[model samples]
Target: MGTERDKGAEQGTVHYSGTEGGWGSVRGIVETALRERPKPAALDALRRQNKPGGFMCVSCAWTKPKHPHTFEFCENGAKATLWELTSRRCTPEFFAEHTVTELKGWKDYDLEQTGRLTHPMRYDHATDKYVPCSWNEAFDAIGRELKAIDPKSAIFYSSGRASLETSYMYALFARLYGHNNLPDSSNMCHETTSVALKDVTGSPVGTCILSDFDLCDAIFFFGQNPGTNSPRLLHPLQEAVKRGCKIVTFNPIREKGLEVFKNPQSPKEMLTPAATPISCLYLQVKTGGDIAAITGMMKHVFAKEAERWAAEKIHVLDVDFIEQHTDGFDALKAHVDGTSWEQIEQESGLVRADIEAAADVYIEAKRSIAMYGMGLTQHVHGSDNIKQLVNLFLLKGNIGRDGAGISPVRGHSNVQGQRTVGISEKPELVPLDRLAEQYGFEPPRDEGRTTVHVCEGIQSGEVKAFIGLGGNFLRAIPEQERMEAAWTTLRLTVQIATKLNRSHLINGQVAYLLPCLGRSEEDMQVTGAQAVTMEDSLSCIHGSIGRATPASPDLKSEPAIVAGLAKATLPPNPKVRWDDWVADYGLVRDAIEETYPEQFHDFNKRVFTPGGFYRGNSARERVWKTKSGKADFTLPKKLNSWGTEDKDGRWRLMTLRSNDQFNTTIYGYSDRLRGIEGTRDVLLMNPDDIAAAGLKQGQIVGLASDADDGMDRQVGGLTVTPFLLPRGCIGGYYPEMNPLVPLSWHDEESKTPAGKSVPVRIVV
Candidate 1:
């Protein structure tokens, strides 16, 4: 079934040509720029973005090009920039006019749309409104509340918006405060990639760089949509297609970005009807069927190799690389041979022929790159799903080479950098010994709470205090209803932010909204106008210097705010100069170099390099740091990532992002690529499934989770709309669909919420 292009579409939905970018994207950028900033300011921000001596785009982790364009920013990047540099302000007067309780009733979009925060506000329980407070006063009050509770009881959460310097200081503060509870945004999104890749490839980050796309013969996309998540990636995909590179996409929905891309930057393409076709082949895999489908592909590769070897003395598989650089081939082969075709087909929701067709493309390509997003990582067997893809790459020695490696498209600008600089719940992941030596304090070695653990802590009352370093933490996680209720029980809640979000309204006993400078705003310090660094998905680190004026003169940089908190909370440690580091960010980078000498050698100098320097991956160089001292071929415990069977008429529901949205932040009600507009409260389902469930198109329905967790998780007022999807599979926007995902329904190892596959039943 397809979206109807009739009068009914005007009510909520519309059908457009399944093409991304071109005039539509240009219109989006223009509308956003005009809405958020003055003409000159918007034009200036766009030109300076992703350029040398300019701020990095706060949208996605896509790397900047070596030879920069006139405008390096994408549609979403422009929206993010304009949104940050918006003239609208959420000032003390605005807060005084609206009570916290009243503001909680506002929509997510409306709350953020109120605009950038302009003051340090403290929640006044007596008046039920946030009142302006001095920075010193806010810090003193927060420090007192923190001292009253066990340090372990406080959760220090971070978002990817923070730069490397800010993240480093935050981590130091948390470690010195006697806990490792540094749960950041990565815990929710790409934790699976870290856990899975580390086990097999020794590195937690992707091995490929931006230049790899130029040499790759084939590109395989698994459950990732570049149109919304990372639009800058479309340029490389478009370029690769023009160079005769084959692109294969395996997703539940045929993403428009992967189908065809009309470069908005290219005047020739924009003026003409010509558009670059992206994906050579697109396979609609089931919501939770990545593992089964990937396994089926591997099965085909092995069969082809065996047939080739028997017919002619030819070896299709890279036997030499497998023997020298990898292990567990025999076990992987045994498992593949043992699995039946029927089982693969049933779990994958795709016939063997289609699976083989995709595998054939993989087999033919001499050099290939495997890339994926949250769709493959946010599942019960998310790690296993990733490992299966690694196994496929290993079969043909696709990794550790030019134009061939695994790439996990990170969502946020510096999420990878945050983790690299020690924003993690895992104690061993960070350089604790070096941090201790550098700061002259003993660091905690205990494992800390993840995002999921933080939720449990909140619910159980163990987490008394919560500190967020830029994000709507309460609204972003699963079990929205439970979180909103449990949030009120906290003694202290501090949100260091650039804008007013829903999380700011969910007041604790004592809540403080600390306004900080955004990426677009100049972060003036004691030294001079400061520059911070961010690492992209390609592991390239570069400097970002804000050029726009600060939204509020009272606002401080994130590093300054973090240092202020540290000074207020902890006693003076002469070895650790918090004020000096905040005064000059170069000192922070120097400390980072000292902590991780190998990775950040000459950190201050190297980060400022033209296109930035790559923090080299050991796996990419074929030097495995795993316990086995080589790349390992691992098998998943189950073919089906979801624990439950496809019985009782339950449908597998996956949460997605609209083209107009980024993470939990909504830009608008429209999703132009998917032909969705005017609403975020609709469910996209296969027509066959809709008919079977006795549901008509555009019918309003409620969805209740089939999780056995005893929680009656449900989301109502959803309009069911027909779309192209596998049988028994459905799609909906994130955070809205987050209610259907149980807090406990997560990946077994990573504890990342399986937001992609929630078993649900329609309620009339």
Candidate 2:
């Protein structure tokens, strides 16, 4: 019983809003995406852009500049642009007029409409207003406060967009300060993929690269929509389609990008208007059923391969490659052979025919890339889901070969890169060994808290304060209600960001909002204007120099902010030049070069080459890093999860986004695909489930979540609309229904909140 209204901003439907086709809404979406408000000077600012050494779009960590393209803008990219170039500013005076409580009441969209923050503002609870203060005083307060505490208690967090320069200093400062409490945005999204991949494949990063997409005959996309999220990826998808390559999507909801896409950058495509249908086959795998679905596909393929070979069919699998490179094939073969079609079909929402159809595509394509996103990794069995994907690739001999490998299309441009630059909560023996060799002191080998651990600790009063480098900690964290309560227990919390947000209002006993320069803004240093490095999804390292001016005089570079706090709180650790690295980003790159020689070779100079270098994906040459020096074949188990069907009498709430929405930032309230307009209060339930619940379609149903202790989190004001989602699951926008998610409902291994699967009950 949630708001089940029609917010249908359907695909390829052009709204008659403006000359550029509601580009203002498009631009607003862009601006809020980057967490900044739109400004009058946006277009002019963009017109003057494309400067030689500028930092690339701080949006989706896609590859940086190569050849001349008029606009490298994707959907999220344009949003980042509008926010960065916004005309509004969330001034201290504005905060003075409206208390944090009042600001908290404002809509998330209205909160951002206040414009770019210009200064370090401290909330004066006595006066009930945030007051502007000098940078020195702000820095001094941090230094003094940090010096007073044990370094272990001081946790430093970084978001995905943080540069190599920033990440290096962040880790160095945390280690030098004596504790390795470096929590990051990765803890929320791909940690499962990273952990699972590392254990199975011997590499923490995804094996596939951009060029790998070209060679793939069949591309299996599981629960990832590139159309709205990573729009730039559509280029390769379109290119693959044009080349008659095969693409199959496994998602409960049909993502628009896969359905059809029109390239905005193409003059003919944008002018005359012809949208291209991308994916050839679509599979509506239930949420959290990817493991079963993937295994089902492989089961069909393996069985067919056996049958074909038994019948003297010459060319089914890459037998030579598998025998030559892989290990434990016998065990894998048995495990897969034992799995039943009845179980796989039941769990995966696909029949035996569906699996065979996919296998047919796989057999036809000589090379293939299996790409996935949060859909696969945001579950209770996330790591297992990933391992299953690895199994699918290994069965086809996909890894360590051209045009075939596994790719987890990471969100944020540098989520993969941030991990590359060393922002892991659990840095293994290698990182510790590197740290010991360079800094002369051993890093604490014990693993620290993940996202859930941090929040749980906070709820239990163990976590002191949340120091977020970037990204919305409260909104992004699943189980919003619990996270908010956890936030209130903190003694001090600081956020280094580009704009105002809900997290600012959910403060600690002593909270500070420090404005930071956007990636497009100039960062002047003693050496020169500094350049920061970022890693793309493909694991390529490159430099970024901001062409735009700082939004506010009081704002500081993220790296500089870390260094200032670190220098004041920690002892001198010479192998790390804290001040020099902060003063000139090149110094930070030099240190990274010293440690990660395998990847960041000549880390300083190479990034200037424009196209930026790829970080040696061993899969390119069929180089497997597993124990046997080859990709291991994982045997998947039966799906014990009944999935959405099992949640009878209980609601299965699936988090999604409006077309106008990007990540946690809701730029506007319209999602073209779902027919939702101007609101996130609606729910998409199946017509059958609606009748089962004794409810009418499109009526308000107050959703109540079942607690582990048999209690319910009664969430009010949700409109329930009986639409078409899978049975037993109701689909709705994320962060809005985020409150329905329990903090404890996270992937066991990754600690990533279960945004996809949360049990709830509804009543009118």
Candidate 3:
């Protein structure tokens, strides 16, 4: 693979910048699949679309009802759903032909290359094939092995894609299994935000919901590029601007999607392929410098208030809300006052004038909201960064008020809901206590490991078995190469998924692939079918029913699968009847309501409508729950904190997904936003770095992390494409370069590995 031409570049293989083929390849896959398909299932409202629904969108986590829009979904969301509905199946016959060693050589796309899982299967190591097995045999085998291992030696990983009902049941099953070694997808991304925000404000959810977005006069978005990640937000953004909301975005790279989005609802905009400009102010902030930028903005606000106070100006600061609602203001004020302009500028990569300008816009508005995403939280100091955002919002009396708050736009539909419905690796006392009271059994009390902690436990042999529900665990884990190693050591691994993925191959000594129904697929339960509850970004709990029929008669719903495993694993408890819950998921919801009366009213009665009720806080505008009895201002540790091993200017890095990907699934290889086509081999770099490295646009170069592990060979030749990014920073496609990220570099507080902030050197 040694095709590089540069003296400094010795890595093998310069991948082509383009896809080689085109959308024609995508069209071919669809056409070929349709031809081989037994039946075609068209999209429609879920069985409980207008009633209480229980499904989360397989797309981005922006929550809304399943309504017909001109733009049904984004390209990635469409791909996620299409892949779910694929008629092509990975049958036992196909697996019998390909050995694990041969399959190991296939690219991630090439393995999923087969199709969706059509039946439950177990790996036969002797034959090196995954042969079809009966549901009883598979579940019993998994249960027997899982029970043999002590619960502390087991780990449960979650994906953001799970529905609230499934997630709750998953949590219950795990708790009953006797350990809290629960790791979810959140640990990889927003775990720090959850930890930081809760410490400061006592809740892990974003302050602003959809209603707030509609009411806000101004919105400051940091580290979120909605165009590629949350395309559904583009609609709301377009609408907000139409109604005169000032939208500001703080991002390192100039994201084209945020800059321009074509709202199909608009007559003029929809007719053409061109996009409408969304973000009014685009601030080019530094990679790990968000805390500095937020602090700088607050300092400007403080200065403005000070000037107003000296002149005896009225209503300059929201002093009424500050005095009555929050604590720790004096400390925060002193920190801002003591911070030198030089430190702020050096750390933030933005000058005082620039920060002041953004502050001026914020201060001018009567009601303002600042929303963020994973872009701000994928650092060693990711939690500190989030607290600073909360500090800013609390400064202005944003929380417990209309049209103002701190918002973290989540990725998957029910990631927030899963956490609420008891999916926490470290569940709080309230939910656990209530769960025990409702179910008449003690819920496990010990805190569990998050996604990163679980993997580390696996690698260290502290954990033996792993059960993943609905996530592409192997591909989703950052530094996935290490995750694969950790996974291989496990005695048992279980994946309940809708599609075939690489996780099936990266197996433990004993592994099982349980095919489950998708959100798009029907989940026929007793009492004339059923619905599930999902918590949205806004804390709105809604119900979803699968509109399409199950792909295979063999496929079971998650609850049913959970019941199957529960029966086999634990001794039969009369009070905790798995059969009753599986018999009617409504019974599960009824139990959930018993545990959480505040959030869930009558779980069955409320879900009968399409627009589900909002959870208590968001619905009732209650602030009774926070530690302060109101929102609190949490101070971040500091922004200038560099990762210990990454201080050598080897380029602070962030892993990004192209528009064609969602979670661990790759729909296509092309990243239309960064202008890379048909592949993820290209790197987005600053022009300054390109010239300093003696490289040019389209010039192929090798990228390697500076940190030394057992392997000094973590380099790859990627075609360079220059962008207007901050110096000492670079961006590249993920999973392809996930190897460069070290597992140890994750945030300890949140256990979220720094996927957005790996340090690497470029050689040409």
Identify the leading candidate in terms of lDDT: 1
- Model 3 spans > 4 angstroms off: 1-40, 43-56, 65-72, 272-275, 608-610, 618-630, 645-649, 708-715
Clashes of each: 0, 38, 17
All predictions: root-mean-square deviation over Cα? 2.5, 4.1, 5.5
Query: Candidate 1 residues 1-764, lDDT tens each?
Result: 11243123324333456468999998887777666754356567778899877779999999987777788988899899888888889999998899988998988889888988999999999999999999999999998888888999999999998999999999999999999999989989999999999999999989999889999999999989998889889999998999989998888887888888999889899999988878877777888888899889989999999999999978879999999999999999999999999999998988899889889988989999999999899999899999999999999999999999999999999999999999998998988887877888899999999999999999999999999999888888999998999999999999999888888888799999999998877788899989999999999998998878788899989999999998999989999899899889999999899898898999988766777788899999999989899999998989978867778768899998998889988888878888888899998887767788888998999899998767798999999898877888888888889888889888888998999999898889
* lDDT at residue 143 of model 3 (Cα atoms): 86
Ranking by lDDT: 1, 3, 2
What's the CA error at residue 269 for candidate 2, in Å? Answer: 2.5
Candidate 2 per-residue C-alpha lDDT over 359-451 given as tens digits, one digit per residue, 9 for 90 to 100: 788877888888888887777677788887887777667887668787888777677777776677675723778878898886776666677
1-764 in candidate 3: lDDT tens per residue? 01122112312222222221133223434543453342445344222222334344677777564343544455455556667766678788888888877888877776665777779999877888888899999988998898888888887777887777788778888888887776777777777777877777767777666677779988888888776777667777777887998887788766765566655345664444445556777777878888898888889999889888888775657898788767788888998888888889989887788788888888888888877888877887888888788788777777777788877888877787888878786767347776676666777787888776776788889888888887777777766776787678889988898767778788889988899888877778776576666777777777777767787889888888888888899887787868888778888888788778877877778774544566755312535356667665666677643464445547877778876677667766656655556667778777667788777888888777766554543657788877657777788877777778777777757868777777777766
**What TM-score do all the candidates reach, one by one?**
0.98, 0.92, 0.91
lDDT of each: 0.89, 0.72, 0.73
In model 3, what lDDT does residue 639 have? 64
Deviating ranges (above 4 Å) for candidate 2: 1-41, 44-52, 313-315, 573-575, 619-623, 627-629, 640-647
